[model samples]
Target: MHPSRALRYALTLLLLPLGNALAAQVQVAVASNFTAPMREIAGRFERDTGHQARLAFGATGKFYAQIRNGAPFEVLLSADDTTPGRLEQEGAAIPGSRFTYAVGRLVLWSPTAGLVQDGPDLLRKGDFRHLAMANPKTAPYGAAALATLEHLGLVDTLSGRLVQGENIAQTHQFVASGNAQLGFIALSQVAKDGRIATGSGWVVPTDIHPAIRQEAVLLTKGQDNPAAKALLDYLAQPQIRALIQSYGYGLE
Candidate 1:
């Protein structure tokens, strides 16, 4: 081989590890309802940008408290737009760095097939032993569920059967495990390819409740972190947005 070609080959080999060396790891706080889609996005983010996102999933309100208390999370993907906006106002997050990534859809779901047909009528009948939902004070989906019940004027009628979960994932588990006959959950929890992939579900109409606008923001700690910015940018990419849509969320 020519001397110049050999030197260039040696330089290329030496630089191969540089990209990995420069890659950063960011800690991300993610809302429970976004679990599945966020996991997919994180994986794609690492592969495409060589930056690893370490995700922690839970209720958005709880995450807000954690962030204010100096949690190590460098980014936040909240279940509601309000939390992010509040964080920005409190100076916990970078102003103007937040944007709605998904508009969530609520669903009445049951592990038993056909059990969720005609959701409103079923709820009005009030025959079920238990109906699970997230903690309305913390999870936006839970608030939407409450709004839905109020819209149907069944809150008082069904008050005796309500079961609350700490987060939407637990709410889903309550129904999936037969502890509750059915539950209100994020559609993404049981959906794939824009359809419910599980036993049965009724997509709650948006007109009945407040829209769950999910927002992503760069936390104050991540202001100088490349991986944090990269992850947010990755989520905004056309392909990632399409993937989010496939999981039953409407894009902003």
Candidate 2:
């Protein structure tokens, strides 16, 4: 072989392993409320680091059960801090590997104009046939919505009219598809560029419910995974945090 050709072949062999190392994939279980921002962040992560993220978006409660049952998630981005804490205690996640990444806001949203005004008053009147919300037992956003209703003294009155979705994403769908007149959804899902992208919504007062402190954790399956750790670190970057904030989430 010519000396130049031999040198080029040697370099290619040496670089192959490094390229493979940079292309690691991390499997992440993310809350449905974080779907949009996570997608954007994952794209940026892949572009910037050459590490890919495989995301599964759903209810945190469901993810918890799956993780406990040996699901193959390397990381979890929960809609509430409680779930990650519980996972850490249960040994489903790495101890002390969790941190609050974002604080989420809840909103009473309606796709139709004039259908929702003075959010609490609309509930008090109980004029709407179907009011959508996520399954409070499975979704933190649902729990927050329920807490807000309880705070407003409208839970019992509105119970009969409530329509439950499996997750926050579905809750938004229920309202958007006209299956329900209005619903409580994560601000991140409906807002873009710091404003509601469509329909009308009222940002629920924080005092009405517990703060939705969203957290991210390294699952036990990811303890030794460099890609997983890198993704977590990337999420904490100032630029990434700003991107998350622009999607209607507050930084912790």
Question: Which model scores highest in lDDT?
Answer: 1
lDDT of 1 by residue, 1-252 (tens): 234434533443454466788678999999999999989888877776677899999999899999999999999999999999999999999998788899999999998998889999899888799999999999999999999999999999998999999999999999999999999999999998989998988999999999999999999999988778777776776788899999999986
lDDT of each: 0.89, 0.88
Clashing pairs in 1: none
Residue 2 displacement in candidate 1 (angstroms): 47
For 27-122, candidate 2 gives per-residue lDDT tens digits of 999999999999999998777767789999999999999999999999999999999999999888898778889999999999987776688888
Query: In model 2, which range of ten residues has the least summed lDDT?
Result: 1-10
Question: In candidate 2, how many Å is residue 129 off?
Answer: 1.0
- Which prediction has the highest TM-score against the true structure? 1
Write down the TM-score of every candidate. 0.93, 0.91
lDDT of 2: 0.88
Backbone clash total, candidate 1:
0
